[model samples]
Every structure is written in structure tokens, then in C-alpha cells.
Target: PPRKNSGVLADAMENMATFAALLRKEMNAHEDNDHEYRKLEIWTRGLISSLDELEQSWFAAAFYRKSVIAGFMDDMSPVEQGDYARYVYFYKDGFIRVFSLLDKLGTVLNHFYDLKTSKLKTHFSYFTVLRQLQLLNVHPALADQLEQIKNSYRDPLENLRKRRNAEIHYMNSEMQDDLWQRHQGLHDKIQLEDLDSHLEDLKQSLEMNCKTLIAAFSYSNEQLRKEISKPKSVQS
Candidate 1:
């Protein structure tokens, strides 16, 4: 459970749907210089795409979870092998979705805040944008909200981040050095990895990812709505 809040995740998901509708309405309700309009269009499309992907990931994880539960039913049968495989598959899918969702959020944050100012090639990590938000200090409410998310997500994200890096940059995350150490013990007992623990972590990661996206797009939607609500003279 997040130390700060529990109900925010549900509210955030609801806000996302409303926010997406407002975004499209704003886009269609106005016109601007070709370059500026094109840029906004592209950015808005990217955000919508990211949101769609995030939702899809959550749904897919649910499907995989069902398969995992059903797979474990006949413990002593030949299907046990397939069940173990499905268990690993769930973790893999969950971690990958978690990482991808973060990256998508990073892109939106970077673009919305104009965080990238130079030609230097730097990875736009989620933390990178959070630090930049603190330094900018332009949106105090958003900064504070993001701070809450960062705090809530910190511990689980630490574990997920390491596993994601291992999978992307090195080798299979399941083949950890610690697991090898355990296998080398005097008893030399090989036990199945703890599916329950992995499931809990994955659930936490997914929840956090949803909260982060909700906070971010909620902020973005507020800003855009403000722009649209302003008088034409004020907009100019």
C-alpha cells in the first residue's frame, strides 16, 4: 500500500478517460499557425497512444494472471511444467509493461515541460523529468502531486527497475546471481521461484504505473483546458 493514499488510483483512472475526451475536444475546437498546430497535434496523439498502450498492458496482465491461476490447478499432472512457464511469462509481461509505461510517461513529461533544450543525447528517464519539474517550480501543485507518486512508487520501482535493466542490458532477470548461490548450498535443493511474491510485486508496479499516468495526464489536461478556456485576447 502507498503510504500517502489508497483511493487515488481509482480516481486517476476515471480522470484519464475524461481527460482524453477534453483533449480531443480542445484539439478540434481551434486552429493555429501550421507549425504550432502540427506540433500540438503530434504531442496530443502521442499522449493518446501512450494511454491506450498502458490500458492494453493492464488488460493483458489480467489475462495472463488468469492463465497463471488456472495453470497451477493440477499440481502433480504433466501440466505443471506449463504452469511454471506461464508463471515466468506473467512476470516478464508485467515487468516489460511497467517499464514501457514509465518510458511513455517520460516522453510526455519531457515534451510538455520542454525539458530537452539541447542537442545532447540524454535518456529521458522518469526520474530525470521529476527532478526537472522540481527545478522548474512553475507548477507547484503538479510538482507536489508527482512527489507523492514518486514516494509511493519508490520501493517497488527500485526492484522493478533493476530487473528491467537486467532484462534489457544483460541477461534474463530470472537467472539472478543470488538464485545461483542458493542452488550451490549444501542441500543443493532446487525450488520453484515464489510466484506469489512476484505476483504481489507486479500488482504493486501496475497500480503505481496507473497512478503516475493519471497524475501526469490530469495535470496536462488542466493546463490545456486553461488555455482553451482563456479569452482569445488572453490566448494571444
Candidate 2:
């Protein structure tokens, strides 16, 4: 059976579809020469509008949809209806949800960037691999990136936690942006290629990352298949 978080995951997946539509709308709406057009600086960025006010703008409609839709519903509960609701996502279990979302974002990022090696200084790849394998294992083979993710993003879980805490506590988006600068570097690397040939080396290197991700998960995917088949509680 699927896990209990299926609803949350489904809502997110549907929101991704909506997000894709928003991207296409924004792309078609913008003229190529427009200063604010989201140029193809990065694969995903190319999909977003150049407007800064539209952060996570793709889900804006789903965020406020009035009528409850069928499989596509992402309706928030009464607890999340108020302004102070942001804090609700910072509690014990709430934090895990937030982190899981980050891992998902990382998976999305993986689709757009070059091969990266994890350089986690504080922890070993084994633990990080297990966590990613369990939670955000979008590609069973993404486990190869686990070494890089763990090694390179040694303390991503903690760093993201701190950044999210500051954003929630101080009402400032600075620290978060600062952290994002590192990711922006990855995007910057993509633009160094010849714009005329239409292919960037970094863009081409994404295959390495995908191979790593797939291998990482496949390392243990078969053994876990049986465990998942039996009626069992989600250990995490």
C-alpha cells in the first residue's frame, strides 16, 4: 500500500502540473527581448516568470481554489487559514514536512544542473543516502548523487532548518537568499556556453547526476521491495 502522506504528495504532484502550466503561460506571455523575461539562465528558471513577486507563483491558484476539486485538491486546513499559520509548519512533525519538501526541490534542481559531488563534512554518505532514499527518492537511481549530496551538501538538512527557522522567526528573507546563492552558482555555470550552438556543457552533464541518483537508489531498491510489500508501518 502507498504511505499515509499520499494525500500531501498527491497535492504536491498536482500542484506541479499547475506549476508547469503557469510556466508555459509566463513563457508565452513574455517577449524574448523583454528585460523581465525569465531568460533561460537555468532550466527551471527559464520556465518561471522574470517577475520577483511571483515566487512559487505557479501554485497561486491552487493555494486559493474555492471549490474542492477531486484528485487535484490541495485545500489547506483551518489551522493554516490565518496569517500566523506559517509558524504551524515549524513544529516537530512540521519541520520534517518542510525538509521533505526541500528534498523534493533538490530533486527538481537535479534535473537542471551539472553533475555535483556531495561533500558533506559533518556526516557520512550512508546516513544521508538512506534518508534521501526513503523520503525523496524520486529516481531510484539518484542514489549516486547521494555521495555528492551528502559530501557536497554535508549539512543541508541542518542548514535548511536554520534558514527556514530564520525566515519564520525574523521575517527576513535575507539569510535564505544567501543560502540560495550557492544554488544560483550552479545555474550560472550553465550560461558560460555558446548561445549560438544551443547546447551548454553543464546542461549536457546532467546525465552524470541522473546516473548517480539512479544507481544510489538501485543499490538497495531490490532488497526493500519485499519489505514494502508486507503490511508494515512507515518506520520514519
Candidate 3:
């Protein structure tokens, strides 16, 4: 079995670490903002761990996908079926975590930048936060960069979002595809979705997410650095 190594993951982890370190350093300098910075640090750490889990899920899915040889459910041996099931489980987990990780990032961005996204919608999404950034005309550089990344991976992200919604709100995502195939015609054996292609989309989504986080944290850290560098006025 071939192992997968993600350069994006490495970059994201390093960027996030730098952001956390800056948060800690600034917390000491501005005691009044210590609580807020502490919360941001915790969230950043959580994002790092979540990214690790998402990567593992993606790797496991790819590994199991390699083990699956059957094209249709009826043709699968018991072992192959088990492998397929594992692949689906991990693939679904990977995509779901992609959005989950972004939402967590959104929460941190909202707090740090004072986006006030909650007022517009109680349970706002990452996309909503992006919109809020634009609407308020704050952090335009970060907002623009993030939007470009989102647009670059729009197709894959949209596909993943559909699957995520299906898995969460309706039936199993794979089964939803199977049902569509059934609508085409009643076949003797149910065919499998394109596991490799779906995995590729998932990989793209993961990369998009990694890039988004890197851009966001890098920009935020730069802002923090500027703030900390500013000189304070002396009291008489």
C-alpha cells in the first residue's frame, strides 16, 4: 500500500503554529485582551487537530479504495464489501470534516475581526463569514485571497457540499448516487460510484481548505504583529 503525504497539511500546520505563538505573545502584552487571545489560541489548536484527523480519514479512504476491486455490489466478495464500506465511511468523514474545519476557522475569524456574522444569521457558515468580510469592507486582502481559493476549487467544493448535505439531511451519499442510477434503469447489480474520482474531488476540497486556513491565519498574524509593534502613549 502506498502512503500519502500532504504538503498542504505541513504548510497549514506551520502557519497555524505561528499564529498560535503570536496570540500567546500578544496575550501577555495586552492583558485586557488576554481572555480573547486565549480563546483564539484554543480554537487554533483545535483546528490543527481537526486537520490531522481529516488527513487521516482521507488517507484511510484512499487506502481502502485501492483494496476495492469490484465494480458492482453484486460482484463484491465479502472482504471487498468490507473494504468498500470502510472507504465510504472514511471518505464521508473526510468531506464532512472539511466543512467542519472551515466553520471552526470562521468562528475564530468572526471573533478576531469583529465581523458580527451572528447578527445576520444565528448559525452562520464559513461562506457567510466570507460574505460578512466583504460586506463590512474589512480585511479585503484576506477576503479576496480566500475568495479566489474558493473559486479555484468551486466545482469540487460544490460536489463535496452536495454529498455532505445528502449524508447529513437525507440518505447515505453513495446510496443517493445509486438511487439516481436506478432511476436510469433497473439493473441486475448496483454499480459503484467512481471511487477514484470522488476521492480526487475530496482531495481537492482538502487542499482548498488548507489554503484557506493558511491565508487567513497568515493575514491575521501579520495584523497582530503590526498591532503589537505599535508604540503606546505615555501617561502624564
Candidate 4:
């Protein structure tokens, strides 16, 4: 027997392996009738690829954290110029990877629901996809499950989203936050961020990403199985 909460990164790795197997089984079942399940299969494959990248990103971030701890100078203070630079480098690396994974997942969900072709093209973020799922009026159970996932991550995701936006559209995310915090005419009082805290935030975001994917893909796989099993007349 395995401990259920071995760790977030470990749990994410296991869940992704499970999802990959499930997706492969589904794809193989429809291999010969390529025309029938092509679009759904494509969407599923995209999700699987994204999950692969997400898993890789987590692994890289974890490695970076371990490296930082094991290799950095033992006496280096966090606020020291040299030490702070190293800490910021890894912190930014990890946070951006988590954010990128989330965005990739969002793209898949958006495509899954055909949100791009809708008249309201602007409504195309992951949150938008979640909202659209709510309004679908079908897949009530699946929608409920996804809603639960969204609610579970509401706070962390919002925080990460703001940092992500700043990183993408303004400046380095850490610098952006630091700038605002240091704006009160406080020289030599600049507070260095704790690397541990940033890693924790990234880990939480990864966990949320993993959980959301498991829920969404599990539901999609179930529907796909049902879709594939129906009588020919009912399919079209």
C-alpha cells in the first residue's frame, strides 16, 4: 500500500501516468475508425502532450530547488547580492514553468469546448472555459466535478495569475512585486523574498494543475467511452 499524500510532485507524477494509460487505451480502441473519433482523439492527444510537459516542468523545478539547497554557499545570506540573484533565478524559473503548464492546460480545455469559434472570442481563458462548462446545460456531473476543482484552487490560481500576467506583460514577476513593496522610499530596506515560499507556491500550483487535469480528462474519457459504445444511429 502507498501513502496517499506521499507529496504533491509525486502525486502529480502518478496521476499523469494513470491519465496517459487511460488515454492510450481509449485511443487504441478507436484506432481503426479514425474518422469517427478523430477530433476527440486529437483533443485527447493534445491534453496528454500538455500533461507530459507539465510533468517535465515540475521535475525540472524540483531539481532546481534541490540544486539550490545543496550547491549554494552555506553561509550565503538571502539578502546578499550574490545569493539573492541565485534565489531569484530559480524562483522565477519555477513560477514561470507552473504558469506555462496552467496556460497549456487552459488551451486544451478551450479547444475541447470549441470556445475559439464562438462569437465571444474574448472569453477564452481557463476561467472562461470553466464558466462555459457551467452554462453547457449538459454534462452536469462533469461540470460539477470541474467546478469543485476550480473552487479548490480559486485563491492560489488567482495569485499565480496576477504574477503570471505581470511576468508576461510587464516585467519579471518578482521584480514587479518588489517594486511595489519597495515604493515607500525605503532604501536598504528591500526585503528579499524567501525561496522556500516561492517553491511552495509553485508546488501548490502544480498540484492544482494536476488535480484539474485528472478531473477534466477523467470526465472526457468517460464521455468518449460512452460516445464510442453507442449504437450507430445514436452516434450521429
Candidate 5:
């Protein structure tokens, strides 16, 4: 059965569409700024697609998670093992995409606000961009809002980041728990972590991601409209 899409995902998609429409309208109105607006348009499109993929991965993970009833590897049937593997795959994909989407947004914000984050580092991340926002004191309202969102979800985001690093650099994230268990004492079978709790954390992170995106694009849209409406003498 197809899982129902989350409202958070749906709202983000809707807001992105509105932002795109406004951006195109502004692009046509302000011919002198077409180049900058065009770049923003491309990034916005990419964000929309990336967000859709993240939601799909999350849904697939939830679907597979429901099929696995075993508390430990020793009690699982072969089918349950396969289901758990699928769950882990999609879960990992979901968390990795969460950061990937944010970094892509960082690129957009960097160019949109002329933050010059690239000058600070050849390759910078979303967190770095956030820091630049604070350091530069550009768009203080947006920066404060984003900072609040990040801080509110700090614990979950940190957990996801550790899993992401482990999955990418060390070993499969799920296996990290198993490795720790082995250090505790040799066991006949591996115990499963709290899958539901982990998924809940991922869900919270996704909500945080959606809120950050909305805050950013909404503020940008307002600023763009103000810039467009200003008299030619006042326009920059």
C-alpha cells in the first residue's frame, strides 16, 4: 500500500512553488537582475526535487520498519532480516539527504545574500554558512530564526550527523551499535536499537528542515518584493 504523504512535505512543496512563481515574476520585472534571479531559480528547483526525494526515502523507511518485529537478530526470520536491511538502507538515505538538501539551500542563500561564504573556505557547509550569517550580521532576522531552529533540534541533528559520518566514513551506522554491544561483552546475537525512537528523531529533523526552508524562502521573497517595488531612485 502506498503511504500517505506527510503534511510537512506537502506544505514545503507548496511554499517552494509559490517562491518559484514569485521569483519568475520578479525576474521578468527586473531585467537588470535577471542573472542573479536565474541562478536563484535553478537552486530553488533543485531544492524542490531534493525535498521530494527525501520524503520518499523517509516513507520507504517507515514502511519497512513496520514489517520488522524482531528485538534481536537471533529471533528474526530471514524475511524479517531482509525487511530490517531495507529499513536501514532507506533510513540512512533519509538522514544523508537531509544534510544534502540543507547544503544546497546554503549555496542558494550564499549567492542570494552575497554572504561570500566561499571566500572563507573553498568548500563550505550549511553550518558554516549559518556561522557566516552570524559573523557578517547579514539578515539578522533570518539568521536568528535559523539559529533558533537549529538549536531547538540540536540533539536530534547531532545524532543524525554522527550516524551520517559513521555511515559515510567508518561503517554502516546500524552496525556501529552492534560494534558497541560487542565491546560490552560478546553476545550470541545483536540487539536492535529503538527503531521507532530513531525514526521519530528523523521525523523531527525533517520537520526542522522544512521549517528552515520556509523561513528562508519566505523572507527572501519578501525582500525581493520590496526591492522590486522601490522607486528607481531608491533601487540599488
Candidate 6:
């Protein structure tokens, strides 16, 4: 019943003494304490317990994202899984795996904007994703940046975006292969580059989006922190 820092409780099995002696020490140590020691002990216990729970939850989230990606990839055709929604989730989750952290849409937008490939199709049907992203408390300026980010392509993927969104959100089964080319609004074409590189870029951009969203949030947070840290005017 002693307080401990969970950070210090690390995964080192060697750090722990034998259980019997440790417990006996705790029992003896508790008997030596007064009211203040008991209070300090209570707070330390809470702090360590809370930290332990937080660490568990943190690792749990990492495991959950990886599991979701694995399940999603396993369920879809390699081609189908390469499409927008699943690929975005895959890369976003991947960004967390690589960076050891995440910041909402911060990582998402960064990857989108960071894309610079002209070796194949430069188009992306990002409207729905951006609209969804907009719901994550994006500012007008950030929205503008997101818009500019999506608008970099020579052609708009509005029809494709609509179809992808419908497929993802409405579970529409009709948006099947090569349907966009049949639509009048779309010149739906891709450059003659191999599909493998195209898919790789798609995934790379998704990962970059994860990083971009993080960058955007960091900027916003820095601004907020500056305001919070500013000195308050003296009261009259």
C-alpha cells in the first residue's frame, strides 16, 4: 500500500524485489505513518493508479487502431482496400504507429498536402473526406488550406468523391468499377503509370494526411498556448 510512479513501474521484471518482503515492508511502513503521511500516501496512490490506467488506455488505443486496419484490409479486396476510406484509415493508423502519437485530423491533412507526385494521376476525391474533416472543428483558414490542398489537381473528382462517400457512409453497392468514366461530368482518366506505384502514392498521401492534420493542430495549439501564457493586465 505504498505510493509509486507508474512511469517508474516500467516493464523491467528485475526491478521488483520478491513479493513477500515487499508486502511486509509496506505493512511496516504504513504503521509508521501519521495523518499527513496517510494523506500523502493517498494522493501518491491515486496519481500512480491514474497513470497506470492512462498507460493501459494509451497502449489499448494503439492496439485498437492496428486491429481495425488489419481487419479492414483483410475484409476487402486488395484493390477495394486501396480505395479512399480504408486506405485513409490504414495510413492514418500507420502514422500513429510510426510517430507514436496523433492529433485528430492534423496528421490527415498533412499527408494530403505533402503529396507531390506527378508520375501518375494527381487527382483525389477528397471533398467528402474534407467535409467530414471540416466537422472536426477546422477554422475558416484551415478549411481554406484544406480546400487549397484538395484543389491542386487539374480535374475535380466531385463525382468520384460523391460515389466514394456514398459507398463508405451509405453502404451503396452500385458504385462499381469504371462507373465514373460513364458519367458526363467526369473525364475519369488516369495516367499510364503502373497501378502499383499509384496505389503506393495513395497510401503515402494518406499517411501524410495524418501528419498534416497534426501540423495544423500544432499551429492552432501554439496560438492558443501563446494566449494562455500571455501576462494578465493588473487589476485597477
What's the lDDT for all of these models? 0.64, 0.35, 0.91, 0.60, 0.87, 0.37
Error of 2 at 114 (Å): 34
The sequence of per-residue lDDT tens digits that candidate 6 reaches over residues 23-112 is 234445445334432333343333233333434433333333332333322354465444534434443333233222222232233243
* Winner by TM-score: 3
Query: How are the candidates ranked when ordered by TM-score, highest leading?
Result: 3, 5, 1, 4, 6, 2
- Between candidates 2 and 5, name the one with more favorable lDDT: 5
In TM-score terms, candidate 4 sits at: 0.69
- Which stretches of candidate 3 lie above 4 Å from their native place? 1-6, 29-34, 232-236
Model 1 — TM-score against the truth?
0.75
Off by over 4 Å in 4: 1-46, 55-90, 97-99, 110-117, 233-236
- Model 5 lDDT per residue over 42-107, tens place: 789999999888878888899999999989988999999999999999999999999999999999
Model 3 clash count equals 0
> Clashing pairs in model 3?
none
TM-score, each model? Answer: 0.75, 0.23, 0.93, 0.69, 0.91, 0.29
Assess the local accuracy of residue 149 in candidate 4 as a C-alpha lDDT between 0 and 100. Answer: 73
Give the true-structure RMSD of model 5.
2.7
Candidate 1 lDDT over 1-236, as tens digits, reads: 32232365555555655665665566677655454434545554554555455445444544545444332233434555565565566577667777766776676677666766222337666776777777778777887898897788678777877887987898888767446746688345345445566666677877787677677877877887787798765463
* Collision count for each candidate, in order: 0, 19, 0, 0, 0, 16
Clash tally for model 2: 19
lDDT for each residue of candidate 3 in 1-236, tens digit (9 for 90 to 100) = 55354587788888899999998887776674448889989999999999889988998999999999989998999999999999999999999999999999999999989999999999999999999999998788999999999999999999999999999999999998789888988865688999999999989988998999889988988998897789876668
For candidate 5, the TM-score is 0.91
lDDT of 3 at 34: 40
Q: How displaced is residue 81 in candidate 5, in Å?
A: 1.3
